[model samples]
Target: MSSSAVGHVISLGCRLNLAESETIRTLIASNDVVVINSCAVTNEAVRQTRKAIRRARRERPAAQLVVTGCAAQMDPAGFTAMPEVDRVVGNAEKLLPASWTSHAPALVQDIMAVRQTAPHLAASFSAHARAFVEVQNGCDHRCTFCAIPFGRGNSRSVPAGAVVDRIAALVDAGHREIVLTGVDLTSYGPDLPGAPTLGLLIERILTRTKVERLRLSSLDGIEIDDRLFALLTQEQRMLPHVHLSLQAGDDLILKRMKRRHSRGQSVALVERLKRARPEIAIGADIIAGFPTEAEAHAANTRALIDDCDIVHAHIFPYSPRAGTPAARMPQLPPATITARAAALRASAARRRAAWLDAQRGTVQRVLVERPGDRGHAGNFAEVRLPPHEVGTIATVKIERAQDGKLIGMPA
Candidate 1:
């Protein structure tokens, strides 16, 4: 338990949530307060949020338990109905200092009306070796299966100047690696002046800052423009790992999901990336058993694990969220969804194992994470190494692969 006198900030869901949680942590001065930053990406995510609320209440009986984040923003009354919750704060209000101490029991604003991106200006994260900077927020696309737009509003971006300044400050504060994160990462900069693209923002950061290792969050395969593609493949400072938001692999399923990318486009993008940089690793988010998904559809998604060479895969079973268009579609049986999810997970595990095995006897530069025993390679391969100084980049020689991780010694 890393509890301090300022209290506990429990963040759930995406990397953006983790980044916001750090900012939330900095705002709290009150004691005996437990802030639950919740997620509502899926029905299962909402259930987990409720479970976390109950558990946090049990853990801190006397503390003022506050619920905030996407879940709270989507359904404030539902969280407010919980006996364990003292206050329910929305995504828009959670970062504001007044929300924490306000007497109002429920504070949720009209998320769609919000135009400006909240500046999460927290300079440092004491617990992490890599700092995550939220350069964008919200999503412009309304995918059939997603309810996140209701929670996060329309797309908005922090200006490139502000983002570069933030990255520069983090680098000056000794953060060696800076990860640019957002809800729709590739959809960044369209809302800002001069309508800069994400590629231009990265180019500015590289030109303006002395940041050593720059990484990106999940990107939409369809959004990779020519300029961004070149920087991703050629820039030495930019990490070689690319995670795509490819929800499904079947073209029909992707169309039904309202995704912009086709199956062939995603595959070709990865192929192009690998052709330019062989060391570049591919990560993707693939969903199993979407609405009206047949066995052939599931097969296509499974094939994507191999076709895209997805070494880092985030597989989710189809969970119909309330108010999503996909929820109104013909639903799959619970057992079928669970079985397909398991199958996809098994495929992903096998692919990941093979990738790790192929990494044996290779030399890698690893960014040592907290506690110093392990770190991740530039390609985002997890490596277990001897104790080293946390946050220091170490060159390691791979010895073996064990339990889905590369075991190595510092070179």
Candidate 2:
């Protein structure tokens, strides 16, 4: 790894996988090799995967093209069959190259025992000097509409000590803000022997490290408990943002989707979060036009979302994958799916506008990730800046909202 060779990583999935790739970037032993983490998380994922391979191969024709992550894990034949890919490893095997340490013994050194990787994201694109740190990988849930179970199996958590060490490194790397990403971050550390919950893991992070701003990627509706919510409420540094995967707002659709939380339960949970973290940017993932979904069911969804105080929404139409149970179920008509998705997208835009309207004339601490004309927005939120450093954090008074960004002037 010390030798000059360009090493690039390709990731194709959710934030958990992306965070894992980030960890790989932090610790790879070669400064000479450029690391590129690619992503593919949809129907276009296969196309993108091929495209990434072609691009990587063209640039580094002699370099080893290691295919890994969900696409590689689930469909090794398809990934390795590509002439560009030299080696095929499952999601777990991809992180191996990053385990190379100077202190590693010559003979007995093996990262197989090192277990889960808790690499803090270093080269974050966040406008603020922030980074993402993966606290865990893999999933235990078997949501009927998902292929993740086929992609990443089981629930194995990173060790508490190792997680703390990675956070220390991230802080040393000048990352003032850190986001913890995982498939089911709420289910963090359950696989460990001592049964350290995410709350316990977070307690360690906040108490042990100097990480300024800490945020979570997404939370499963069923996993939020008093302890974790309490920690977020208590910590000022914990960013006021929670992305809840509200796959469906209708109870019938939710039941079919196999989301553990009932519609009422989800609504109640959102209300609870609103009460505890009022200023929190509560977001949801809505799967519009699910199989067997009626027009009335979708109506209920829009109504529920409207009433939920959800500020941000990412709506995905049911895209049936071959392996998922939903794929075998009565499929939603593609045209219907498209219609519902468009409606939901418009609704989300309205929600964004409403949320931005609420923020006008208020002061928000924005994390300036890039240099504009001058300064930048906080929280990596964009704004015309006084052109400061990429990692600069600035407090700005919001004048208005424009083009999905909170426009502000220096506070």
Best candidate (score: lDDT): 1
Error of model 1, residue 374, in angstroms: 0.9
Residue-level lDDT of model 2, residues 230-271, one tens digit each, is 876667888788788888889999999888888888888878
Top candidate when judged by TM-score against the true structure: 1
Q: Each model's C-alpha lDDT? A: 0.92, 0.70
Question: What's the true lDDT of residue 117 in model 1?
Answer: 90
RMSD of 2: 4.9
Off by over 4 Å in 1: 2-5
- In Å, residue 245's CA in model 2 sits off its true spot by 1.5
Measured with C-alpha atoms, the lDDT of residue 1 in candidate 1 is 42
For model 1 the TM-score comes to 0.98
